[model samples]
Target chain A: EDKVVQSPLSLVVHEGDTVTLNCSYEVTNFRSLLWYKQEKKAPTFLFMLTSSGIEKKSGRLSSILDKKELSSILNITATQTGDSAIYLCALFMEYGNKLVFGAGTILRVKS
Target chain B: NAGVTQTPKFRVLKTGQSMTLLCAQDMNHEYMYWYRQDPGMGLRLIHYSVGEGTTAKGEVPDGYNVSRLKKQNFLLGLESAAPSQTSVYFCASRRLRITNTGELFFGEGSRLTVL
Candidate 1:
C-alpha cells in the first residue's frame, strides 16, 4: 500500500522559533512532492519539490526532497503566530493523476 | 476566476440517505480529484477523473461513486450515508502539461456529517 507518514503530529512554538516538519513516503511511480498550508477551508500551495537535494523556497518557507531517503522536510524560519496551521505533504504519483498525502503536522506559533 | 468550486459547503444527513457533491473547475484542467479528510487520515483520494467521461477509483473508493460526464465538472455520490462517511470532502483540479509538478488548486471543501 502506498503510504505517507508525518512526524510530530502537533507542535507549539514561540514566535521567532524555527520549525522543521518531516514527511516520509512509500509510493510507486512517485513523481514529485508538494507542500500546502491548510488554515481553514482550503489548503494553499506552498512549494513543489521534484529533484533530490534541490530546495524549493518561498520567503520564510522552504522544502527539499531526498529521494534516496524517500523523505522530505519543510522548514519555516522565524515562525510567527500567523503561521499556526496544518502543514500537509503529498506525493503526486505518475499514474491516475493521484496525490497521496501524509497525516500532516499541526503547528501552533504563539506570540 | 473561480478556480475550483464545491457546492453544499455543509450538509447533515441521516444513515441510509444519499447525497451528491458537485465540483466544478474553470481552469480548464484535465485532472480532477475527490478526497476526504479525516482526523488522522490526512486526505485520502476517493476518486479521480483524468478527463471528461473518464473516472477511476483511488486510495479509498469503496462506498463512493463518481461521474465526470462534463469536462469541467465532477460529481461524487454517496449511495448510503453512514457515520463512517462523515468527513470533510475536498475537490481539487490540476493542469498536467508534460512532466508537470502537479500544483493542485482546491475548493473550500464540503463538510458532511452523518447522523
Candidate 2:
C-alpha cells in the first residue's frame, strides 16, 4: 500500500515561535513531495520537493526532502495567527501521475 | 482567469438521492482529479481523468462515478447519496508533464451534506 504519514497531527504555537512538521512516505514510484496550506475552503500550494538535500523556501516557510529515509520536513519560523491552517503532505507518483496524500497536520498559532 | 471552477458551491441531498458535481479547468491541462475532504481525513482521491475520454478510480471510488466527455470538464456523479458521503468536494488540475516544482491548482470546493 502506498501511503504518506504526517506526525503531530495537531500543534499549537505562540507568536514568533518556530515549529517543524514531519512527513514520511512509503511509495513505489515517488516522483515528488508536495506541501499545501489549507485554510477555510481550498488548499494553497506551498512547495514541491523532488531532490534530496535540496531545500525550498518561501518567506518564513521552508521544506526539505530526504529520499534515503523517505521522509520530509516543513519548518515554519515566526509563526503568526494568520499561519493557523492545515498543512498537507503528499507524494506524487510517476506512474499514472497521481498523488497520494497524508492525513495533514493542523497548526494553530496564538497571538 | 478562471483556473479551475466547480459548480453548485453547496448542496443538500437525502439518502438514495442522486446528484452531479461539475468541474471545469481553463488551463487546458491534461489531468483533473476529484477529492473529498473530511474532518480527520485530509483529502482522499475519489476519481481522476487523464485526458478528455479517460477516467480512473482513485483511493476511494466505491460510491462515485466520473466522466470526462470534454477536455475542459469533468463531472462526478453520486448515484445514491449516503450519510457517510457528506464532505467537502474539491476539484484540482495539473499539467501532464510536471516539473519538479509544479503543483496542483484547486477549486474553491463544494460542500455537500447528505441526510
> Which candidate number maximizes DockQ?
1
Q: Which segments of candidate 1 are over 4 A away from where they belong?
A: none
Evaluate every candidate with DockQ and list the scores. 0.88, 0.69
Model 2 lDDT per residue over B23-71, tens place: 9999998899999998878899999998999999999999999999999
Model 1 captures what fraction of native contacts?
0.84
Cα lDDT tens digits, model 1, B1-115, are 8899999999999999999999999999999999999987899999999899999989889989999999999999999999999999999998869978788999999999999
Residue B106 accuracy (lDDT) in model 1: 98
Question: Which candidate has the highest lDDT of all?
Answer: 1
Instruction: Give every prediction's interface RMSD.
Output: 0.6, 1.4
The per-residue C-alpha lDDT of model 1 at residue A106 equals 97
- Listed per model in order, the count of residue pairs whose N, CA or C atoms clash below 3 Å is 0, 0
C-alpha lDDT score of every prediction, in listed order: 0.93, 0.92
Q: What is the lDDT of candidate 1?
A: 0.93
